[model samples]
Target: MNPTPTYRDVATVGIGGPVGSGKTSLLSELVPRLREEGLEVGVIANDILTQEDANRLRERFAGVVPEDLVAGVETGACPHTGIREDPSMNLQQIDAFLAEYPGLDLVLVESGGDNLAATFNPELADYWLYVISVAEGDDIPRKRGPGVVDCDLLVINKTDLAPYVGADLEVMTRDAREVRDGPFVLTNCKAIDGIEAVHEHIVEGVLFA
Candidate 1:
């Protein structure tokens, strides 16, 4: 006789960024750390016509998370559409997770690789992080895209690549501060540097809030 749970019934965090911005790498690192905290988590990766990111996450989270909890939603349109304009697909996936695992603590929704304009619909994500890579350019933050400006948190990833790519971390830091009122973290996902800060932000922004 219980009511069916909705996406809002569970905490959801959406991760969105340009292609090759290290969204997947960040997820791979964060999920295990969350598991270590003893929280049950689910993940949904949105793609245009493939489950590539979802499959990769499943493989990475194999021992830490249940395979059934990681799912891929093929939007068959622009990446932003599924998470922004129309989020029915993502909402449905979250509902499915709650049905199967009522105790699920969190669900991380990773948007398909997109441009700087991509953002998640509030109805779909209680909190969202927008990721960008130094490899892309030091000018990205100064460009002031909505993804960077509106997300609950802005993640500047690939700091290790900054030196090699001629991206000035100092410039990125200054611009990020100027553009977003929210907090931003500099991360090197490959080495696991700064991942903890990202996790803490999520924990505070959603789970513990």
Candidate 2:
């Protein structure tokens, strides 16, 4: 028999980007800051076949967010399917989170590393963020992938590595502005720089205006 479940009055945010683009690092930074602002947050990390990302987040969040609130979803297929084409697995994990942590105000669902075409199923996310790294190349924004053009917010991470990688932030910024109607922010997630702006977007776009 299915167990009776707890329903959550929560806003879900989906985070997606190419591999090594700092999606997890951004979450690491965002979760604590959100908690500091008095929001109860849960997290789910989706991976193609491993729980590595989820384990990392569990350790990073530690006592700030209950361990049970962080979970791993193994998609067993392309990362996008679990977040976009179909999202039952993520939805179920969310329900479980809500059941365990009553009054949970937000859930950040991190999609496994995927290309720019990936996006969240609207049913699974109230707000979504797409992350890209300066290390990927200065031309990423110019590519104008759906994820970059469609997400509520776009994050250009690893600003500190820009020059080292020969990525021109100014050009990327210009291209991003040309391709999207929404806002984009530059970040060095490892240093916690620019995370406050990302948090502000979440607050204004989903939590409270």
Candidate 3:
């Protein structure tokens, strides 16, 4: 008989970035789009001590995703500990999801706000995205942190705030290209700008690829 399938049987995507980088906002936009395409998507939000992000997502996806499929993992430590260093907790959650939803097409894991050094364990995410805010300054990409340079896609969010924050989008664009061999998208989550490109990358990177 064929062995029972596990989380590995489904596609997993990781979204990591610094505090207030708009990871949840991106998820709010992406999940509905994926559901509209007839894809069953699960979501997990990892926070140090609170379920704030997860709870917010559950509310946002109330009609789109089943309440049970959206979970929160409190790592009790740095966000990276749950997503990168020791992903056992996250893995177990994914396993639980697969048990109830074997046909699940994708799982999006959002790490608690972290520094630019955060990254997902290969065993945890099939594809990963690193989100940064232009408000954080255009120098973020130039720093070449692992999260920025190594993620499959680098998302520069809050572009609409660039002018007010004195962040130069052009410099960020140039620096991101210089640091990452992969593609990056500039997004304004509030207005849903450039979200389509982000969705396309995920569809191609993990869903269809």
Candidate 4:
């Protein structure tokens, strides 16, 4: 028999995107900002066959939150299974975090690298953000994959790399607006530029609004 879950008091947010889209980098920026707002947060990093991403986050969030609250789920296949088709593993991790940190107010679940079709199951996430890199090209939004079209918020990251990568930020913005009914933000996560907008969106979308 399974144990009762103790995480009902916590809100779960899922972050997903294609490989190299800076999903982890965004988390490195996001977690700290949420903490500053005085929220107790936990994080789960999902990866294919390795705990590398979880290890990275544990180190990144050291001292801010308990290390046990940061965990890695190894999917061993397409990243989407543990988040979309089936989320039992992710759910179990959330329960573990809550058992340790009952006051946790929010949990961020980071999916492993995936293609444009990746999306979170509503059963797993109360809210979800899909990230894509401007370096991936301005044409990305034009693709209009379910991941981009269905996410609560679409984040265009690494905006600073647009120049070297030959991506037109204006065109990306236009196409994103044309394709998505939801809000989108352009971010240079490393510099922490535009992060506040992302934080505000979460606050309004889930925390308070």
Candidate 5:
């Protein structure tokens, strides 16, 4: 079995993937599931320029997720620094959340959804997930990026769009398994399919509950 995620004083999970791979959409689905499970979740969106994803989440989750719980980190450089190279700002945001909300159970850091090369620093996240979409094509796994091989979990989303995009879902999953030799999951956020498995994966793998 894979090693348990490194324990942090505060639980931090990084959600990362390629652009438009449905990372944010997974968050939109997960935040509510976590809340329903009574987890007080805090979110930090790492954006390349504007706080578009952060703002979108804020407006989308308005009443469901607290306003102050969401924050944006303007990733001046490539999307990696905010979560990887120097995670100082992200760590600061996490500590600030713990200070402001003592009982915060989990913090989800949504990376800007960069290329397959991006990953999270352990200093920034106890556990990390790499999201890819079926729409990106099956060869993504064959590319064997660190994001696919090293993340705590591999999430292949947008299954509903697989046919429209002409992506081979089965081959994608098989390649992921060959690359990861570990846990991988598929989902369609639009249809709310496989979301519970995602939630359970985080709860069992990251939160250890």
Candidate 6:
């Protein structure tokens, strides 16, 4: 039987993407910013083999995002199946977080950035952001993966490399817009560009109303 869950004011948000698409880096950036704004944030990192992402986040976040706020799940090779097909482990981690940090304002559930086929269970988050990278190729948006089409917000990251990589930022975003039928954003997380737009969108779209 599962242990009693700890309760918190956490609003869960799921972040998913393909490998090298910058989900962890984005978390490294977001955790501190959220704290600066006085929002309590927790995170659950789901990985296929080990707690690598959780440890990376703990080391990277340092003092901002608490050590306990990050939990890791072993997906046993099928990462998407862990988060989407069977999320019992994920739920347990979340319950544990809420039990510990009762005042937590948000929980960022990060899937092991795998492929375009990955997405989160609605049961896991009030909202979810699916990330893609400009370096992955411009046609990714046109592929219409459930991740691209169904996520509440689609984040096109690594925009700073667009020119070098021959990725068409405008067209990629246009295709994302056409497919998502929701907001699409461009971010250069490495350069810290356009992140405020993400923050603002979050506040308005999920945090407030």
Task: Give me the candidate number with maximum lDDT.
Answer: 3
Whole-model lDDT values for every prediction: 0.94, 0.92, 0.95, 0.92, 0.88, 0.83
Residue 118 in model 4: lDDT: 99
lDDT tens readout by residue for model 4, 119-152: 9998789999999998787899999999999999
- TM-score (all chains, Cα) for each model: 0.97, 0.95, 0.97, 0.96, 0.93, 0.93
A best-first ranking of the candidates according to their TM-score comes to 3, 1, 4, 2, 5, 6
Stretches of candidate 1 exceeding 4 Å from the true structure: 1-5
Q: Tens digits of per-residue lDDT for model 2 on 127-177?
A: 999999999999999898999999999999999998899989899999999
TM-score of 6: 0.93
Tell me how far candidate 1 lies from the true structure as C-alpha RMSD in angstroms. 2.0
Runs in model 3 with CA error above 4 Å? Answer: 1-5
- Among all windows of ten consecutive residues in candidate 2, which has the lowest summed lDDT? 1-10
Predicted structure 2, TM vs. truth: 0.95
Residue 193 C-alpha lDDT in model 1: 89
lDDT of 3 by residue, 161-184 (tens): 998999999999999999989999
Clashing pairs in 3: none
lDDT of 6 by residue, 136-177 (tens): 999999999999898888989999899999999989978987
- lDDT by residue for model 1 (1-209), tens: 74654777789999999999999999999998899999999999999999998999989998889999999999999999999999989989999998999998999999998998898998899999999999999999999999999999999999999989999999999999999899999999878889999999999999989
Q: Report how far off residue 167 is in candidate 3 (Å).
A: 0.6
- Among all windows of 10 consecutive residues in model 4, the one with the lowest summed lDDT is 1-10
lDDT of 6 at 162: 92
Q: Identify the superior model by TM-score, candidate 2 or candidate 4.
A: 4
